[model samples]
Target chain A: MGEHETPADEPPTDEARAEAPVQHGCPVTDSRGQTVLHPTREQYVDVVKALADEGYGMCVDLVGVDYLLHPNRPVADGVTPERFEVVVNLLDIYNRRRIRLRVQVPEHDAVLPTLFDVHPGTEAMEREVFDMFGLSFDAHPDLTRILMPEDWDGHPLRKDYEVGAIPVQFKGAPS
Target chain B: MTVSDPLVRPGYVATGEGGQEMRPRSEVTSAELLREVGAVLRLSEADAAALADSDPDVVGEIDPDLDDQTMIINMGPQHPSTHGVLRLMLELQGETVLRCKPIIGYLHTGMEKTGETLTYMQGGTNVTRMDYASPLNNELVFSMATEKLLGIDGDIPERAQWMRMLLSEMNRMSSHLLFMATNGMDLGAVSMMIYGWREREEVLRFFQKVTGLRMNHNFVRPGGLAADLPPGWRDDVLRILEMLPPRLEEYDTLMTGQPIWRERLQGVGVITPAEALALGATGPILRSTGVEWDLRRGEPYLHYEDVEFDIVVGSYGDAFDRYAIRLAEIRESMRIVHQILDKMPSGDYRIQDKKITPPPRARIDESMEALIHHFKIFTEGFKVPEGEVYVAIESPRGEIGCYLASDGSAVPYRMHIRAPSFVNVQCLPHMMRGGLVADAVAVISSIDPVLGEVDR
Candidate 1:
């Protein structure tokens, strides 16, 4: 969405919307002077592996973001915005450079290939995204919850998940 | 949940659904071990294949003659040495740990979900509690992210930047002090605990005088600080700085040079640089592996570029190296603090922007407009430009980061903190492997994980 896109403003025309995003070989954008690459779910691991070979050895962080409310959020040309995004930050210590990869995962099919093969450090973080967002990884060994109980009903960090909808339960309280 | 259910097993969860289980070494085929163990250990295919070939004690298939000597044991959810409610399930063969898994979330309270409800102006209070030991760093990272989004990151006054750096370095010293106490206590140096707390308390006293709270001082805010430094804050800081060198020397005498301390930690819980990087361990754990990576030096944020300091590293990535690195870092932090004192600039502590900064108390009392502005700023809060940014800084633990997305509203669209301990805790299993069960406490203490940050 545009920075000044108020609810009162007229909806963007198809022609204007088409021309907004600049074309790139692989839809790249910048946020606050940092490089951001928008990769599809399929290209996620390959991009990370290639980056790893190029000295981005450490996978600093991997997080899941739900874009349910901001469905119309902006993206680079040739990139489609999905309901969910897996944001991975990779660091090249030798070169002192950092690159961010944003992989779009559709809500209907929210599975992405695990990055465990490339970066084993992402084990807990991948489990965390799975626990919080209900997004599964294709072959994540131990894809269970990391920060939630085994019997958790739904992903808590989802936009639609109500915060206090369920009654609080004590271990030995009267039902 | 009934007792008869197979899912319920005292403290152990059955393997298959991402749970870790240790099978007999004889039963684990080379291919199976390469696929399973190799992944967990981040071992290369060549290395895994080599490991499989080297173990020629028995056939690849399960040997009926070989007994399954390994038994799984739970270390903590309540063990005093865990630092907090961290639970570790260790698969032990005799006393050697074959496989280990860390089960966390005993302290989870969904603080990220809570961050969405609070406006950006009030978000500092929520993040400060994540790493309670280094609350200023938490607040500093969050504020930096928010300021980046607000596009006033460059406009921050020189004095404010210096002040933030001062508080951050001081927080590092205090957190390391706390670690010294816990590491000593965990290793049976009970007297070191008293000495550690004694020194840390003095640092906390300085924090209390400046921020009005010992731990979670939401004092560092988005625009600048919540308030300026209290009068005579320099004298208070100097007193603590002067008092620390001698105490640190006393610690060196008591623990660093002691044969018992060296024997307990020297070769215990060793991790190579490859493993540390692959496992995502940072801060002292990464540095202890002899990898020269420090955010302040490698990627300078705030006025770290202007300051002079050395990145301390270790030759052998052992528990002793970790302890020694942190001990040396305390002295380095003091050096930085002294430099900050010398170069502390004079200017407004916060930005003078009317949109973000609240009016002064005297102005609010005398003018109706000022009062109304204050009310609006506090109640409604200012809208941030629609964008997303991730800001990371070197906390005492590792890289504490804040990822914020705004939809041009007072309340953030999404807020996430990439906590260091959360990632660093993953190293436990790899580090504990092949070590004696007794050394487990040493490994845990060396990590010095603050559960509040780990589970947050």
Candidate 2:
């Protein structure tokens, strides 16, 4: 089993996984020594739940990345690139480890399952994502505009959103 | 009408979907109550159910008159005790706070949006404004993330790392000192505020001397620092170290021993360890729960591994514990600063890479190529390799992290600051849930949230 093992007699999984590592049914890639798992939109919550069960208890950060221009950005194999990516950094404090989950969301649908059921701390972070990226979270307790006014229009963090283009009315003279 | 049109339409209400206004108690459903209670307590399903059954009065479901008893009120967007523009919608029944929701974003200036427009060389200035209390920490995280993406994180000079540690520790002392002042002021010990500020000013004086600005110094940059330490910096640092110990002892006498101060904070705004962790609270708040997790010790970013210091923790996760933790943390930071003073290396302050670091000011005067390099670096900025990195360091408040995504451009494709205050502020409702309305100020002070960091 050790020295003269043929391809047929050998385990097919270990060598195959060495070429492309997968974790929690998602393609895992190492980005600068950090473990990054690329899970599809459908598998996002399940993978997060699985990781949480395995002791990635604290959800440290949740942010959205808009790839409107850089649509061809490199992702791990077997993962489809999408217009928007939600990055969640989970910390396993007991193990002193961190894992990042990058789930791709299409431009049209722009919705993902909420992490509130798992990590209640993400309530505000998810609201910020929804406020800044225009991506809605399904079943979020209060998915309101957090860092923007409740009445404000357009998500500001999207790549397509222009900067320094909002027109303002002068209070004193114009009226 | 096109959404991207620049013109403002007359009589258009914009159709924003959500609001922060608290609904009346009668309108709130049992499901919503369960969710709110579960969130505020961070309790598991069984515990939440158990609580509902045991204390129907607290859940407000059994008594129909409870709807009329509790009234929702706005605490602040401008209240003096709120720290900044943090508005809390509290449902109060007489003096007891029933449910609370923090309404933030009053200070949101779209700094992350601005980060995308700013080049890598100019990114420091944008991030430093977020956590104004510990601007150096914000700059340090941003610089570290940028350096990591540039594939030069390990090549940073020993002197630069020590210098960064020095400034970072000094900033922590000053920030905690400010917290001492504010925490005292919030809890009604007015004189302690003056003493706290006076000591903090001593630390800021050193910062101003080294960085040329007090707050929002952007001194720590990607390659290393904006400049080398000013002449006689060691003596200045020693002076801060010399001045702090006794002043801190005085604070211990002024506020720590006072019975009134103890009454205000002890057993008030209490949170369990699981709730604190589940809420993703870090730094003093998490430490106050006796979880000995400090990123400086756990992750060992920069040269923290070489330094010897103890992580200050508290047994009870109450306001008193949070206050005591911060006070003790000031001493721990000073200890770290002393270690840095002894271990501070002598060499170049920034990295010597020609591509990332601009030509020295002296070189730009003599050679045309040096002048062009300097101009190009300041104007176009250096391009970073395509990658994304999340760099978190223990800031004065909590874990201030920078998540930078590079598209191999001079400007970051998407720059996001995982601000600690933004996450820590979420604990306010959980902390204030069953406390008196007056204790809310003490709760807010214990958290020590800087709104710029939260709203950014």
Candidate 3:
């Protein structure tokens, strides 16, 4: 995104940037006003354990997004400490409730506590995250590349990682 | 010999005359798999041309099918029930499943990691890849989470909400239609393969009418939908509505009451009500076990609070119950689609605030502010002050959720999906225990797990 980030850019009006994080949950504000959700980052396991205590039993998915063009967080964070951030979604099947737990990690030793005791299903999901993003989970049972081969290098999902050998102009892709 | 489960056949897909009979699972061997994968993974045309071998899993049990003692059989990464590229290690004795372990992540693409880098509008397009079968739910869930963080639920225009509900229900029907078609094909009702695809294509055609794309309509966004329903979109939907009922009846006659359907489905894949809750089954799989809960009714969102619809549930959580619940849900979805069309409020399709939606095509060139807002959303993107929100919807399969985190950036800080297929697949081993090997296909069909959602 550095290529697209013109030097002339201006921060949003104070009206858009002034909302602070909530005290208890650290819920953040979006572009809208007075939203109850506070956006804050925590240790990945703390977010999971907190939600489990709150009674959501399911850890459904863990997805990765490269921040090459992100305009908010420091794009270079992945290259330094707090470089990699991962989102964990938990669910309360009985109550039909849900919550998002976000955690940021520095690149050199990108590691976080595991939530395997809380949701055993996270075992495979975390491994795939490790396999894809190269983020390490401190206590994950078998944190190996779950999808890509062991020899694959660089996190394909990162903003800085070029698609490389994969032809960007492959034919027959869906429009 | 009589074979129970339906197969496309191993190197024997001629479909007519005696191509060959598929061997039962007990006769399959690991050496054969090692042999075949060893070849295909490294096979050239010389290796390919000489390949007269059938699919290894179907050729025969590479290992003994049933020992008096239970042995775990890995059904996929290649088989169908796990859906997509799932590998289910099934522990069984004779035909009864002793335990099941679902091994996943064969289709992980890490779209969540990609979402953190794209703008808000791009997130909608990125998240849609998670659940390819019913994509509107992904868009809706992501939009709702963003709206929750932005504190703009009410600001979303009435017309957009109404249109979203309509599209959601239609997406539900189309998704279930695919499930039914596949379920029927799995159970040997070949004509259902044709009929199910026909109905699904009709719905997809309607989706193309509104979103210009069929599978992943990135139309629903935080502030509102991508755009208004095209002129005559209501009529296009009505065409399918008019004909869908009779087609559903054909499916009912072909599947619901047939003796074999009952035997294959009933008493199979039994999960107790308690187990359904404990195992985290939602949507039809949980509801069929007698849990009368749906987010639309229990935790109403969008226009559900204003609409009239029943939460479909079955008394016993079995394969039959799961299958019936889907049939029932198709009816419920139809009812909601009608109410949305009849009561839709007309107004701006998206919020008037310049922060969330892109400036309309007309305003992009004329108004400077609108142009700036448009450029911001596409480039830098709008920021959610800093907060997290979880939004879930009742997709055709079950609960499809979007968990989003924002640190005042155009891209999400973190985005996680709580896909239902991934959850319901957990109960596969429990349901298959004590069931016949033939019942495995029935149970898989009833669960209707989609690998896209699971592996994502």
Candidate 4:
């Protein structure tokens, strides 16, 4: 009888059902009360476009983070956080709500589809991520070095990159 | 006195021992001279190739059809009109700009990478240097983000909130005033520069009185300010408020109606609302495009919701609209400052949580525990729970957000600044694409990008 009981027959509880973890293309709120969506690298563009359709028009910021050292960074259960993550912040101007999309990219193939087609503002930002973290954006029009020199030796912002400094010389100091 | 001596003038020759040969220097083209110099310097083809590869002036591919007529010109990493060390590559066809690409990183100090090394407590010092024009705004955004990451957003004192509002508003005024000065100079209104700087100096004097620095006031810290406002702070604020309104009117008289000012800005560098939104433009730039989206009004942080001020909007999204929006925003900021002075709270300037902030100097002298707590707070700095948060404030240039990710350590795992100038400068090409080359200066000045923030 318990198993066959209609769902409406059950008494309503005071507590709302905790939102189920979104495994596919739905948005979930993070612990910090931010609406974070974990979209697969394949669904990145579609998810972003869906959110954009829901009035999240502006792509406020786009940045890449190298979690090489901080592999233990928390994510919802059953979701595997990858070595490189591209975080995109979207703003719903009319509603004044913010949505962050975190897409995990594998180390071997650190390539993600470009959001430039959906959000033209991501052109420079995508270039910046490519320049800093050695991540690549497929179908990006001008995927060239932005901040670093064109022939710069390596991606300087990666966690594993060496921190090198050149000693400053004074006018009268020995060479 | 040899007859065929190459040293002799070309027209005359020395035939005998007694005769003098005079040779005019061969008409050397500049290109020939350069070739000879290159040959003398032993510049090989490999060296030439290397130079071309490393040359900062190397322009990207231009349209093949117009390449013959379009000449690429470099405008700064040094020019005064650029406002900072911003370099622009302008492909010009006769006086019209075919395309303009803003090349940054001349002033890049890698502040985001540097932020990873500093503790949460020391984060303000690094961020404040990024947007040096609006230093306090950087401090405010960084502090707020750090506080949010620490989950102590509600723990900030009421007095600190109002103080933050007051000082940040004043910083906005100072930053706008600087734009006014530079904009005027860039557009050839040199006298406006003098007037603008004079007014800005007064504001800086007030900043010095409160924060102990004319620029880079890293006084705003996580959990609250470095210290409470000094005595007579209200009186000083009142004087500034009183002094500014009439000066604003004087600017109206000087430039608002001036034909040259109007001509240079009114219809130049027009950006549509769709373009502004798609480009993620915020602050005055977006507002100038008739979008009433201000973080203060839209997503109120601190006590901005409690304050009474109108979100200034512009009708036409042009250079003039941007200028008008900034001018009106200064007045609105003053109004907010006045409101703050009236409703200023009397309480702890910073949170009293000893774990986050150091103990008062007076308390340290009385209690050994206080001294130890102070030492630990400064040297070790309190750790934040592992999480990430992005907090943005309506900075003078635009939305300055700090995206901070914590790994349960005193130092942030990753700190990415969504610097408004960095994002806003991307729109320059959009604005300057088809405009006359002369209007490029007007457009760049109107955008008012701070290169420090852009490059960082």
TM (chain A), candidate 4: 0.82
Candidate 3 runs further than 4 Å off = A1-175, B1-74, B80-82, B91-94, B364-380
iRMSD for each candidate structure, in the order shown = 2.3, 1.6, 11.0, 15.8
Q: Please give the C-alpha DockQ score of model 4.
A: 0.27
Candidate rank order under DockQ: 2, 1, 4, 3
Model 4 TM-score (2 dp)? 0.86
Clashing pairs in 2: none
Give the per-residue lDDT digits (tens) of candidate 1, residues B183-284.
999999999999999999999999999999998999999989988999999999999989999999999999999999999999888889998898788899
Among all candidates shown, the one with the greatest TM-score = 2
Instruction: Select the stronger candidate by TM-score from 2 and 4.
Output: 2
TM-score of chain A of each: 0.83, 0.85, 0.65, 0.82
Off by over 4 Å in 1: A1-25, A169-175, B1-33, B40-67
Can you give the lDDT of residue B207 in candidate 2?
A: 89
Of candidates 3 and 2, the better by lDDT: 2
Cα displacement (angstroms), candidate 3, residue B394, comes to 1.9
CAPRI class of candidate 2? medium
TM-score order of candidates, top first = 2, 1, 4, 3
lDDT digits (tens) for residues B41-137 of candidate 4: 3345664454445423332211224445766677787988897998887768899875566787778787889999888888889999999999999
TM-score of chain B of each: 0.92, 0.93, 0.84, 0.86
TM-score of every candidate: 0.91, 0.92, 0.72, 0.86
